[model samples]
Target: MSTPPASAGTGIAASRWRHLPVGALETVRGNLEDALLAGLLALPVTFAAAVLGGLVGEELMEPSGPATTLDLTSRASLAAVAVLAVLGVLARGLVIALRGVLMARALAAAVRAGTPPTEVPAPLQWQHAHERSDRAYRRTAIILLVILGLCFGVVVPAAVQEPFLSGLAIIVAGAAVLGLIALGIPLTGTVLRRRQLALLGPVDGHWTQAHRIIAAGHVLTGDAVAAARAGRPERGHPGSAARRLGKVATAVVGVGATAAYLGFQVVAALAFPDRQRWAGGLPGERADLGPEAERMVDLAVTVCVVGGAVAILALVVGALAGLAERTQEQAALRRALVEGAAPPPYPVLQRYLRRRSAPLLRMVSALVGVMLVVGGTLVVLDGVVDAPSWGSFAGAGQGLREATGLGPGILGLALGVAALEVALASLLEARERRLRDAVVQRWPVRPAPGG
Candidate 1:
């Protein structure tokens, strides 16, 4: 093999060895800050999980009837909730840990990119960076805590007391929180930028370029790290194939389970009219659904089933596509490394960072979509089946309320709230991606010499 150039070796040595301590320290500080933020972000989820777990636990332990045995559907619901609660707890911790690792890699790559080949960054420079990051993290955590406290402590409790208004209150509270976060991002970035300029004397475009290089390095490193963690198949690695197969199997199982649950609900609804009470209808009363109403119900159920299947299929396809993209990203990273060139700009990295809990977010979105479909279907059925019997607008309204009760009403409200959340998230993500792309273009990374 031909010997590498002296400058190339020196740069590698400096980044890998001489400046390793600075990078390591920065990584630790960043991870600590991120951990705090993660914990704060998890508070609402933890609360929800705890409440769900408690409810499910109580239901499971209580006697269902004279035989003390629960029906399969009741048992399934309780079990599913319990499992979700446990998974939520586990997923929280796993995400935090993964974020820590990602931060470590990003910080290391950033330190390497920011530091010149001839000089390691001064300890004071690292200290300044740490302070800026710490301040941002602390402010975010404080704001999140305050928002969560207010929503859960005051808003939720007050709303719960009013049976008629609780759903509305929950929706409003959720939207308010998402809106606040959306507003906070740009505001926080502006404040931090000003703070940076104040702390470090105004400099030429080089300073801005260096910051951009560091950011690009972070993004590239994060992509590489995430791709590596994805466990793509490697040549001569038989076990990698098995792992990839296992991942596919897991996805398939998840889709199947969701389909099974939805199918069970539909079958029960059609077969056991008395059990409609569980879905907020009156017990022991026949819906007396006419042929037209029955056809509508069938159509609604079929739509729900098909909609759910499509959602799951979309999720699976997305996952597979992501896996393939990650594999390509890894190859690109390797090529960039070998050729000493900057990787192509990847705007998705910005979106990925913003959506750290993407899997969870997607799941929730799917669930909300399902809820909307089911709830709307029930509302339509109520108006169709009962409105004719009641024979007047006022009577129809009362009949609709009595038939659907609080269940579908809450689901409908939740769907509305979720729509707001999705809109806000998309807007913020697009803005962030644009900002990141602008930064990358303005301060493009320089290619290394002697590639």
Candidate 2:
């Protein structure tokens, strides 16, 4: 309704960077660049250490324990492994640090520029993570939808032919996702920059939907002040910054994770110095030494660890698989609409559906998580609670038969139950909301899209 003074926008942008003195932008950028460098430098070494990769960075000195002379004549190899483990630790620290630096830089930039940032607001961040939680709900909704056109939909069912290959597929799928993000990041930035001028918002925090374009413009400046006060999606502010940080963080984390694995191996090796050569149980050839129960326990631990890894990967897939479904189904709908077929249902339906399922779904998710933890804890407890006497469980070998087996079986069952719980709760919640709509006087319901 009125033309604001020219100084208004300038003041808003200035408020974004009160800490910025002379060349603060340059400083922020340099610090960010250095953090990125630290991340890159740390990656390979961290990964090597994590994987127990024998590629050594140092020579082994004599260890104080009996492990010093156990079977491996090469202390050199042992030292090399130790060095790798240390490297992994260092890399992990660097990665987290780098990610923080990236976040700070992006926040700083947004503050200076008076533009919004992209990270979902804290309130809705859960749903923004998309497929991160519910496998069953996504499966029920997306499977039927995605399957409508076999040509576009066959990949998922086709991949089920071999469960072993599914992990590799998940990893590959993750990589492709990264690739798409990489491709889109710059394009998104370009779109925002071009549209910057058309957008304008009051510098104050009071503006709502009527002020979105202005908020979008403020977000573009990467100005933290406007961003915090702004309501619209921060969109571009941290997107690029986050991308840079992720690479650094992943390398760092990979190293730490790999080092943990190696440490476990070394610990195991040390515990059973003659593990490969020594007969497992009944050292003196006693008749009562070996038992099937011991064997059962060992199997459990092995399964849990292996299953945990699978669960971790599945977690990633479960987290991302929703986004994939979102993207794929959205794409399919677009195609159908383009083909002049019965128009695909309103795209908003999918979003609302997800939004609506939010609470009950989250409850289910929490339920499942609790279940997994309880189950896994029980398994781990059983192993610790009753490890058979050394040399008693002859065929089972200490830990080889008992500890590993018992730990995982219980954990696996818990995970499955957890998954089921999240799905069922979501379904129930949706049903309850619909039935209670009249009685509740239209208590606001979340859409299935979450945000």
Candidate 3:
């Protein structure tokens, strides 16, 4: 083997290193004003949130009666709150910063493509689009990770220790966050898909070209196209005997799982003693688990209910996505056959659906991860901290230890949240793999090329 000259080798290595920072520098250069604004906005918010948190923590950790002076434990507790507040504010800042950067890049791309600012960016080649999409996916994921870290490490844990009314208030805040995430993820996905489709506009007029684009984009199978062309049934379609059976099996499995989970929920509810007079019947007639136990049960039920709701929502989304996919695939095949491989101008509806073939599971996973972090942190903090009055954080640590038996401890909450995230991630990943494999398997068994 011959080695390259030293100058040539050095130049190559140096070029690669130089390119590494170009993207970042470009982003910063494009969004310099927004970046500065983000920095400016972040400081005050961070300081305000942290200082407020510290003050709140000081009040919580104050002695039972009148206490003018702070103790060591109290000071430490205040510091924890301050740290969490800083994290939350910083997370928000990061979101602002990242959004600014994305917007700037998108604007630049649009200009380069000569598309109107109001209209979406034209879709790039599928390969290029896919690469950019992967990068976007990773960036979006990092933003979500930051949100989760803030929620789990700061907001929920810090806020949930308030009085009953305040606790409810914070829980509502957490729910609002979840709602935002659910809405945001789907909206982002729709925008991305629309942009991709817009990019494919030039090829829209030709059916043959569009067919190849769709196939190359992994939107439809060649076999499906062939079957459609010949006016025959597409093999392995849902209408097929095996697929129909599979559908039935899937429904049965889903129903069984739902029933089992419902049963478990019922059993859990019954197992917990009813303490409130309104809940059971008469005051003395209802058995009361100590106040702590009751609170713990309430927290557990809330977590379970929220988790269940998320699962149901995910299933609904998955079902809708699957239906949409099948419809699009059939429509693409139909258009291809009917048009006789006409050049360009693919059906707009079919093209839209085809371009959006990427799974929503990953985005949904990120949303769920954020929700779990917030919910789990809230539940754990509620169990551990008892902020009866202004300053009561000093005793919270002790309360946390005692409440361990009543509620799922901090460790258990963390573990449960982690497990849920893992399960959802694994399920989605497997689904994506199966889908890719099925598409790959759809290649024609025998080629009629150059015929």
- Index of the highest-lDDT prediction: 1
Per-residue lDDT tens digits for candidate 1, residues 377-397, read 344444444445433323224
Give per-residue CA lDDT, model 2, range 235-339, as digits (tens).
332123333444454454455445445543443443334445443221232123145633433443343334334433433334343434444444433443344
Q: How close is candidate 3 to the true structure, as a TM-score?
A: 0.28
TM-score pick, better of 2 and 3:
3
lDDT tens digits, residue span 1-451, model 3: 1112212332212111000011333233223323223333333322323333332333234443223222322233333334334443433343433332343344445445554222221222222322333233335445655665566556666666888788779878776765554454444456644654564444232213434333334333444444444644433332234334435545644664464356334424544344343632322332345666555544544444444444445444554455555555544444443444421122222233222222233333333333323333344445445455524544444544343343335435533643454455344433433332222223211112220
Q: Could you give the C-alpha RMSD of every candidate to the true structure, in order shown?
A: 16.0, 22.7, 17.8
Q: For each candidate, what TM-score against the reference?
A: 0.31, 0.22, 0.28
C-alpha RMSD of candidate 2: 22.7
C-alpha local distance difference test of each model: 0.40, 0.33, 0.38
| Number of clashing pairs per prediction, in order | 0, 60, 23
Candidate 1: residue 72 lDDT (0-100): 21
Give the distance in Å from residue 140's predicted Cα in candidate 3 to where it truly belongs. 18
Candidate 1 segments exceeding 4 Å error: 1-75, 90-286, 346-451
